[model samples]
Target: MNDGPNDTTDLFFRDATDLAHLIRTGQTTSAQVVQAHLDRIAALDPAINAIVTLNEHALDEARAADAALRRARATGGGPGPEIGPLHGVPFTVKDSIDTAGVLTQRGSPIFAGRTPQTDATAVARMKAAGAILLAKTNLPEFSYSTESDNLLSGRTNNPWNLERTPGGSSGGESAAIAAGMSPIGLGTDLAISVRGPAAQTGIVALKPTHGRVPMTGVWPRVPRRDWHVGPMARTVRDLALAYSILEGPDGSDGFATTPRGVDTGVGPAPQRRLRVGWFTDSGLGPVDPQVARTVQRAAEALRGAGVDVEEVTIPALQENNPLALFNAQHVMELKPAMAEATAGHEDEMFTMSTTMLSIPDTSMADYLAAEQGFERIRDGYAEFFSRFDALLLPVLPTFAHEHGAGELTIDGQVVDATHVQTFTVQFNITGMPALSMRFGTSTDGLPIGVQVAGPWHAESTVLHVASVLESLSPVKDQHPDL
Candidate 1:
């Protein structure tokens, strides 16, 4: 509502709910809000490279939104047509999500010049809710890597420490939101894409139960059972708000037909004590002590708030490493499409995709074998959740590392850099809803986050627990100096 440059800068940091309230009350025009964000993006994006493609018609859309607001006001607060809950708020979308007439390159050189003629179901839903799309954030090529870098868009730097990575494949979205380039955005999670980057950049993100949100137009679709598209924001409430608008069955995606729905209106802490299970290690790999301690602090805080929190282990989580399963499934499903898209230009593909193409094809027998193991992981979580309302764990074994490092150290143990997904991939295999939220900071002042996973289709419970942690977190309001 404040139009002065200094006030507008602060406004950019406000969550989507606060911005929407200002616009709905007629204290600020959509045009002003959109312009302020555009200015911020223009000023900061060069350092982070978070927004790869800016929407040229954003200001025009804002003017139209202001006109709509005016018309709604003229009607004396009585709705002629329903005004969207997010009317006049600006948001960004990951490049993997299609936006009509916007370039959706998918961070692959093969898709250069690609523009979608229609919005993806998720994007359409947000637009219908009156949210404006301002740009598309970057990602790794075909979203295959945990770091957001590609030959097409270069690398996206972490807002906290430019020398380090903003974890990807959804790294750009996390960076944009954390740097105040966008208050809310969309990100995809297959393994740790959304949660990992959010953890690294000190933001909030959700990997809703697989299929809770339709994946109609996301690219390089593979591991169909594990892929998810979810919301990222500065606050748990904003994440819930976006989820409410983006969720529900779209009729086209069979995975979206679940009867459960998200409750954006999480009014207060439950009157009854909720049982929660907390663990510092998932048996996937060793966790950094700081990361582990952060989870411990979150558990202690929950216990202080009257939630019955205790340490528990899912031994079955150690039975299988899902990296092979994911690689095999992705190679089986995505190779042909990459071959077709690149055609004779195969030599120009991103290094990761190029390496992926060189890997031998996965036989049906091998893929089926992997599926059988995945079923075990899913069953393990089902059993665990049957006894506890939710499970809490660290999002990664360590904080964000120097980009392209071949190895990392966690608690004096050396680990392959690629193993960063060790703690996160199992959830993707199990199709559970997970949230990553800022909880603590590293000695170097980098942010650390913890993951909260709930039963299938239990996004509301996940958000509720995350809200409690957010309230208790020392780093909840922390941001990068940038």
Candidate 2:
């Protein structure tokens, strides 16, 4: 791993959309695009440990894409266009999501040699859209922890600071993208996986309305409703592009019942003002002052853009704690699944798997109440969105921290570390679409992200608002030195 500045050319850092355009226009070959990313992975992955498996056929696929594009050009781009919108772009996936013929270890020793016979619906969709799979990223054991570490693949370090975590269970995806090893990738968001890690790594991630992307072939299906498969990338446009491909049911994942909706376009609505509500303290815990300021700044930026941005609190957030509710519900539901997976391989369990097994299960009454509580949270967000088009809030109460952070000090007040999911898990339980993008920097110089969430199936609006914030963000094009 190179501990100093990355010496790779700008090609590795280019967004997936740009790479696709280059390939489409014959400015660059898919082979060169794939080679650039492979080179970056070879140069930087040793220190980051973000990769669990590489798609050995990636270059072959890129070559095939180039040939297809050439054929299309010769045919005058006729009849349905032989290539896809993402033709020739390279992408990655979290190890928890299956990749046909590739290892899908779920970051656990018990499933160390596991390989799926088919790609997850999201992966299949990405491939169908002409993206070459670059690699499979690391995750926490069974994607059960906030830090991406397990007995099988070790830990993933943040590109900003090696000692600090990139945030998980999608940490590997975030780290790989931030370091230019992957232009874009797919991630599974259970509680805070996709969005939180994006915040830490200063990238953009979108957890489209739950079920927008099917969770087919992803692990921990016990709590099927919350396993959201979404895209993470350096730009919001990439998220929009990927989401457009990943949505719609695959005839599996019953929760993915919503039919494909019309694309609302990610541009500003000129006829009406978009209303956005942002808040710093929603009562999850005392947030870091810097994070609070970042949220405020995002709200102000939107206001300056002619958006109706307000600082308000939701009664649902204040009355119901998503962090507590997630733990209460998932712990009981997930333990039995872990038990089955680790049955004979108990000795191979990591702290995450073992600790989960040790926890007492929730009583049936409490479990039922928690289910209702989740519904109430969903209803609250629904009511809030009835008046507002979007919401801007901190993705986490603070910036990235060192690995194994069991506790945190926010604004000089000690708080449970689990509060890290305070802002993120709300959408997880509600199945609302939310995004995490860098809007500010902390005193420690790590990127701080603000969450932009929308009501059910409102991804286009969420992306539009995020794009505006992205363009106006003061912290732009800042990559980690290494």
Candidate 3:
């Protein structure tokens, strides 16, 4: 590897898969890799402001990892019987997720100085896999806003332009990975938290099938059925690796339906022709022409690679409008949850939290109707997936916009900004597995990501298709200038 100025940058840029291999083979020590990231954070994080809290024991654990590798090398010719797939690699967690002994403020003064006695199930699993926790990234207050700014941790800036948002409630996690502060991370998705932020940052993120990974350690338990926790990284392969290790029942989460120890590999399966459906508009909001073209390019790329690709749309998406459906049911439900969380600390609540309180609550009748509407959407997807194996669509209707940028103007027609979640929230409602990965770039040079979603419990198919798209992507190994 080349040395000097770019050396640390090189270390941080490599995906978790490559970094773990290097560490396991003794070509590089875990300490070196971990410190390279810490050094990067020390030098560059001031401007990006993604990472909010550091793991005090990360270097110590990395050193322990290095020692374990030495012992394993002396005993056997491999990474050792004890080393897990993520052995020695460093990772970050969104603050909304718990980390034992580390501050998890949840981006609110209400949660400031709050630290858990044990890691969230996901964090513990990563630790069990030998991945060291490097830090805790920021989020919107109570993880409620589409942006990552909060009264407690301030705001996280996009690594790409500093002026644009990285997207939230997982914005800090995406921004950190994009800036090389961390290779892989853990994030939650209620609506568009993980995938949206990943799209904004030019990285890869997976929101596994609802309950595929448990929600034992994350906050916002009111909407237990809708929230999901999964992986985010610089490369699709890293996401696959993290997902394999993170999947299955934790025994504690009732929502986790997948059997324990289920790891569906991302590689090709038995011989079968896969059909992928592509779309730009979901019939809810206007999609930017560039975003539409990117989706088309991805479809054409797959077609050229010998995969069957067809332009299609789900009627339910256009009729029900998942984003609106989500708001209808969740607004009333979540407002109470937020109220409960901020009961004694009302003065500490952020604008998003207060604004949500002002919105009228849905009646039991309308809430029930919204729930039924979502079921029709689920049925619609089940029928749609019967024909296609996966979907290719835009993660965002347009490229990253300025922080708190009000109203999205698509093709000169202004629309509500929340319409950005038009494509992603559908998967959350249906409990399908979906992912975001960089495929193309905007004219102004921001990364554009395409969404790949599969039927429930079909993450392996999703990853397999994503791996192909990753190889055929028009943009690769591109990083922000931070």
Taking all chains together, the TM-score of candidate 2 against the true structure is 0.96
Q: Is candidate 1 or candidate 3 better by lDDT?
A: 3
Report the poorest 10 consecutive residues by lDDT, candidate 1: 259-268
Worst 10 residues of 2 by lDDT: 1-10
TM-score of each: 0.95, 0.96, 0.97
lDDT of 3 by residue, 1-482 (tens): 22222455569788888888878877788899999999999998999999999998999999999999888878887665699888999999999999999998889988889999989999999999999999999899988878999999899999999999999989999999999999999999989999999999999999999998889988987687889998999888898889888888888999987795454433366366788999998686788888889999999999998888999988988888788889999987788888878888888989889999889989899899899999999999989988888899999898888888779899788988887888899988899999999998889888898999988888888998999999998788888886
lDDT of 1 at 358: 87
Q: Rank the candidates by TM-score, best first.
A: 3, 2, 1
Q: How do all the candidates rank in terms of lDDT, highest first?
A: 3, 2, 1
- Model 2 off-target regions past 4 Å? 1-8, 77-80, 262-267
TM-score-superior candidate, 1 or 3: 3
lDDT of 1 by residue, 98-176 (tens): 9999999999777888999999999999999999999999999988889999998899999999999999999999999
Q: Supply candidate 1's per-residue lDDT for 335.
A: 81
Q: After superposition, how far is residue 236 of candidate 3 from its true place, in Å?
A: 1.0
Cα shift from native, residue 371, model 1 (Å): 1.7
Residue 406 CA displacement from its true place in model 2, Å: 1.2
> How many steric clashes does model 1 contain?
0
Best by TM-score: 3
